[model samples]
Target chain A: MVVTIIGIGLIGGSLALSLKETGLAHHIIGVDRSPDNQRQAVALGLIDEPAQDLTEAVQRADLVVVAVPMDAMLTVLPLVLDAATDRQTVIDVGSTKALLLQAVEHHPQRSRFVAVHPMAGTEYSGPSAALPGLFRDKTLVICDAPRSAPDAVARVEAVFGRLAMRLVYMDATAHDLHTAYISHISHITSFALALTVLEKEKEDEQIFALASGGFESTVRLAKSSPDMWVPIFRQNRENVLDVLDEHIHQLQHLRELLHQENYPAVYQQIQQANLIKKILK
Target chain B: MVVTIIGIGLIGGSLALSLKETGLAHHIIGVDRSPDNQRQAVALGLIDEPAQDLTEAVQRADLVVVAVPMDAMLTVLPLVLDAATDRQTVIDVGSTKALLLQAVEHHPQRSRFVAVHPMAGTEYSGPSAALPGLFRDKTLVICDAPRSAPDAVARVEAVFGRLAMRLVYMDATAHDLHTAYISHISHITSFALALTVLEKEKEDEQIFALASGGFESTVRLAKSSPDMWVPIFRQNRENVLDVLDEHIHQLQHLRELLHQENYPAVYQQIQQANLIKKILK
Candidate 1:
């Protein structure tokens, strides 16, 4: 199969590597707006070639992977579907699904498009950050799967399966809500934590001298690209807002317990939080 | 030299392993209130023998290590110092230093006591969780060094140096304040994040099915033992509360930017947080 992947950065470049490694895609073409990324993707052998035209690339490929940032995905998804043939399958690896899925809902080749989000990433970006086995044993969410043609959905599942990802199906609305709770809120909290410590560090130069594994892990996501996250938060504004409010409320409750020197209540809350061990493991 | 390590949990047990590996302690002694811990510490070869009494352990060793939970450290540190001779050196590895240092400020053997906080740990606890080189390349904050005898401070420094740890000296008050920003606040945010997601999971069970590395890293410290954290927070309440307020303020600001559809402002804030990349690296 010939596969064309748009925006060959971390997710897209990694996906390209996986497809080639699994022998699922005999020829992989990359389409990126940045010349630097296009050159890096080709240099790193993440893609067979860099496509000069999106419509031409879509026309030639049996499968198209739209892995652009959220804002660009709105226009790119519709364009990919516009050029998609009946036999061609197009899938997006976006973080937020509701708006992107809605953008191409009334398109003529809508049934050929699949909405997917592979739940995996790191705090780095660019083609150089592309990693092998990036999606192994990770969850892959297929949003609004009922709207897509059976063959298209099956092709997406087959491709992700080859990458060793677990498939979970959900409607676009549910996908947005759940990801806000599990993924998006984590980035926000980490960014805020970095800002909090950075603010304190300004007053005392020694503040970060004592930062260890705990602080590093908790604030690691703060280094994620804003170009990627601002769009996600903007696209899923209401759900993101809802989770942010709840997170702040939880922090305030903890602060109140600490203020009262209520060690027992604090202990109970930590024990409750410890239940995550079962889910995460 | 002989070393007696009280409370053979994560910190103490790990220290025993490091000392043995570095040949700093010819004979290591373990002292814990729990019989299970004593058995496990010995079986794991963390110590050569288990001491029957705290006073006898302190008396026999040239250096004493008090690695109990912060609440136990209050009484245990003073007791260990009570048993110390002019030639003996004692150090307590507690998270919060201000209160622990104050508790033994007026002791006749005060100059024999060195208060230290090794700025390194994992979420797990106990003898089985003990690891070699846990303190390697991590910061070791030596608090109120001027109060400790010159020889006592030098001995403590030499031990941590053999474990490949960098040392930073600060007064107890500054140590508590800085740790509140870099360490204590991270745990509270993680615990609160775990509670927020867990609360949402109650309504939708599939929420965790999509959790990825980002979520896990941000919530990792939520798994830390409350037995260790509660006393640290209880002692550093005011400082923890201050950083918590700032963290909440930053989150609320980000939420407002999202609410107003201020993508530019949100992007700027994230870029600011990205400065942590320099400090952390």
Candidate 2:
């Protein structure tokens, strides 16, 4: 099948590489709003050809994969749906699925669309950061899959299977809530950690020299791009806020334990926290 | 020099291996309360011999290194001072400096003590987790060097240098505050993050399989020992609380941005957070 990946950057470019490398797609074409991204994606062999002309690209495509920033997905998705043929499948790999899912809820060709969120990425961004096996051994969350045509759902699942990703089907609302706890809050914490240290600590050299593996591990997501993240935070607002409140409460509990010099209580909490080893691979 | 390390585990056992392998110490002796740790340290060749008695271990030693859980340091350090001769020096490699420093401040042999915090180690612990050159190229924070005897400080610095550590000098209070920001809070965040995800998500296998590098990096410290971490938190209570407050406040700000659908504001905050690249090596 011919797969046209729109907004080919880290996620889209990676998807393009995986589909082509796994022989899951016959031809991979790129559709990016940035002229530079289109040029770069092609230069880096992320796509067979740059689909600078979306209308022409959509005309021949059998599958349309939207891998753009969450905010931009709203604008571009409707246009793609309007132009999609009967056989053409539309899917989105946005972090926030509920907003995008709601936007296309009543669309005429909504049955052709499958909302997906592949839980994989690196701190790096742009077309040059694309890696062929990026999706391998990751989870591909398909939200509201029942809304899409059986053929379209199967097509997306098959593509993910080819890349060695495990598929989990859930509603858009459930997907958003799970991600807010497991993924979204992590990025916020990392960004806030970076800001907290930067605002208080004047000596850059000291932070660099003294940042242990623990600090690096916790704050590593601070390196992620603002363009990709801002929309995700805005789109998944309520869930993110709820999780953030819980996290702050946990920190406050730890602080109270410290203030009281309650060593036994603090140790018990850490031992409980160590239960994370069960969930962590 | 003959070096004796008490409570041989991750930090102490690793130091023994570095000393023996580098030929920095003629004979390394280990004294641990646990028979398992004692046997493992000797079997792993971390020490030349394992001493059953702490008093005997220190009396014959030229230099005694106490590497134990933070709670036990206060108890172990005083005994070392009482047992050591004028020719011998003692040092404790504990995460918290203020408490340990204060406990030894009034001792007649106070000048013989050197307070060191080596910012190193993996999440794993115990003698088997010991690795050669674990402290190499890592920062070693020496607290209140002026209070230590010149020769004692020189001997400790030379030992650290032989193991390829870069030494930095700071007072006890400053060391605790800076470490709270860089190290202690990271553990608290990781522990809470693990708890947060565990409470909300039910699929254990899915969480393990789908834990990407982002999740691994964010929750790495959850694997640390509660026995080792609890005391550090208690010792550095005020400083840890201060940093924790700032971190929670930062998360609240991000939540507000998301709540308002302030995409631009969210983007700008993350962009500023990306400045952590400047501080992280």
Which candidate ranks first by TM-score, i.e. highest?
Answer: 1
Model 1, runs deviating above 4 Å? none
In model 2, the runs with Cα more than 4 Å from the true position are A203-208, B201-210
Q: How well does candidate 1 score on lDDT at residue B157?
A: 91
TM-score of each prediction: 0.99, 0.93
| CAPRI level of candidate 2 | medium
- Candidate 1 lDDT tens digits, A72-160: 99998888888889989999999998888778879999999989999999999999989988999999999988999999999998889
Question: How would you encode candidate 1's per-residue C-alpha lDDT over B1-281 as one tens digit per residue?
Answer: 99999999999999999999999999999999999999999999999999888888999999999999999999999999888998889998989998888899899999999999999889999999899999999999999899999999999999998899999999999999999998999999999999999999889998888989999999988998989999999999999999999999999999999999999999999999999999877
DockQ of 1: 0.88
| Ten residues in sequence with the least summed lDDT for candidate 2 chain A | A201-210
CAPRI tier of model 1? high
TM-score, first chain, each model: 0.98, 0.97
